[model samples]
Target: MINLPMSAPTFIKSAEIYRSLRKKGITIRKTIDCLIAVLCLEHEVRLFRNDHDFLFIAEHFPLRIV
Candidate 1:
């Protein structure tokens, strides 16, 4: 798992992304979404989420979600 700051942006961003993806017919767990966000921010690794949340995060940050 990746580490992340306990900040509003992180939580809000994660939730917003999670909701969007949930609406898009993708399946993603909240725990996994949070992990992905942390990895993207901390490890600088690309994320691959079949969920809408990844798409949303990619739009704002430098991330490659496949």
Candidate 2:
């Protein structure tokens, strides 16, 4: 597995984002999708996923999907 230094701010921000998204009725899988988005943004790396939401976010965000 790829390792990343889990910063305090990143963890807090990710949790906040996840909670807000869950409150909006997004699925757990979607919350993970958003987490992956945060990771990709922080690392400046591309993500390969078949999840539709992942693709959607990747389209609008600075992610290269493959």
Candidate of highest TM-score: 2
lDDT of 2 by residue, 16-54 (tens): 656665566654465666767777778877777777876
| CA lDDT of each prediction against the hidden true structure | 0.63, 0.67
TM-scores of all candidate predictions against the true structure = 0.47, 0.62
* Cand. 2 TM to true fold: 0.62
Task: Report how far off residue 23 is in candidate 2 (Å).
Answer: 13
- In model 1, the worst 10-residue window by lDDT is 26-35
Minimum summed lDDT over a 10-residue window in model 2 is located at 54-63
Residue 53 displacement (Å), model 1:
9.9
Model 1 Cα RMSD, 1 decimal? 4.9
Model 2, residue 17: what's the lDDT? 59
Name the regions of candidate 1 deviating beyond 4 angstroms. Answer: 1-3, 38-62
Q: After superposition, how far is residue 61 of candidate 2 from its true place, in Å?
A: 1.4
Tens digit of lDDT per residue, candidate 1, span 15-48? 6666665677754545566556755765567676
